[model samples]
Target: MEYILAKYNYWIYILLMMIGLYAMIAKNNLVKKVIGMSIFQTAIIVFYVSIGAKRGASIPIIAHGHGHDVIATAVSAAEYANPLPHVLMLTAIVVSVGTLGVALAVCLAIYRRYNSLEEDEILEQLR
Candidate 1:
């Protein structure tokens, strides 16, 4: 129980991913599937962010401009957190938004063409 309590974020991320996967795989509506995809992407983003975070850690940047013309403060790497994961996650967020926009546009196009959003209804019309 102590271990589970310490890693509850992981469990929440898993639950969110499962919910998104189920919606994408089991739902009939194209819009719902797109929403599920977004949800899945969000869960992944949160997971990465959570993994990148450390308790009581400061940013990687060092400050040295306080009442001195020379660099006087020195901080080891252990004192700062790595910013790569968070930076990459920012890029991922932009890409996810773009993908969601394109996917919803595609869904809109499908609805216009078939007059429906249900996958089965669209397939029946195609047949």
Candidate 2:
């Protein structure tokens, strides 16, 4: 049961990624595309967080008012979660938000120009 839970989470993330990617590529509406992109980005974040998470580990950090090196000194090595992946995840989250914003803005521009959100309709209008 424990192995199943662990494996299932990974599979769920993979399935979400594939679904989001398919929606992004196969959908006809610009808004739908943006939604798909967001889905895809979120799946990636889930994957990252899952990779960093251990079943019993506590988040890595010194307790309040404790110095940076204090936790390292006080806690046993086995208790703390890895900090590196969490930091990388934070950066990735910011980038994903930026990308999503830009994608939505572009979708809005398309809607304004064509007065429709469908990709096929926009292409038809262009041609």
Candidate 3:
């Protein structure tokens, strides 16, 4: 049961990633592509956070009570979630937000020029 639960998290992350990729490829509108990009970014975050979780471990932050948390005392280095992944994820989140902003800005410009958000319509307008 424990093994299954642990693996399930990864499966869910994979499913989310695939769905995001499909949406990105299948959609025609610029806004929908941006939405798919955001979804893809969120799936990556979910994967990172899932890896951070342990079967019985508390959060990495130490509390004042009892010198350190009891759960923290029990884990060895190999079992503990690495802090680097979390830090990298923070950067990924910021980049994703910036990208989303730029995508929206470009989309607005396209809309202003073409008066339609559809990909085919934009292409026609451009030609």
Candidate 3 achieves a global lDDT of 0.81
Tens digits of per-residue lDDT, candidate 1, 1-116, equal 99999988889999999999999999999999999999999999879977877777887565463666546566566666778888989999999989999999999999889999
Q: How many residue pairs clash in each candidate?
A: 0, 0, 0
| lDDT of model 2, residue 37 | 86
Best by TM-score: 1
Predicted structure 1: clash tally: 0
Please report the TM-score between candidate 2 and the true structure.
Answer: 0.84
Candidate 1: worst 10 consecutive residues by lDDT? Answer: 63-72
Evaluation by TM-score, superior candidate among 2 and 3: 2
Q: Give the range where candidate 2 is weakest over 10 consecutive residues by summed lDDT.
A: 62-71
Question: In model 1, how large is the Cα lDDT of residue 21?
Answer: 99
Candidate 1 runs further than 4 Å off = 59-72
Task: Give the TM-scores of the predictions, in the order they appear.
Answer: 0.87, 0.84, 0.79
Which TM-score value belongs to model 1?
0.87
Q: RMSD (Cα, Å) of candidate 2?
A: 2.5
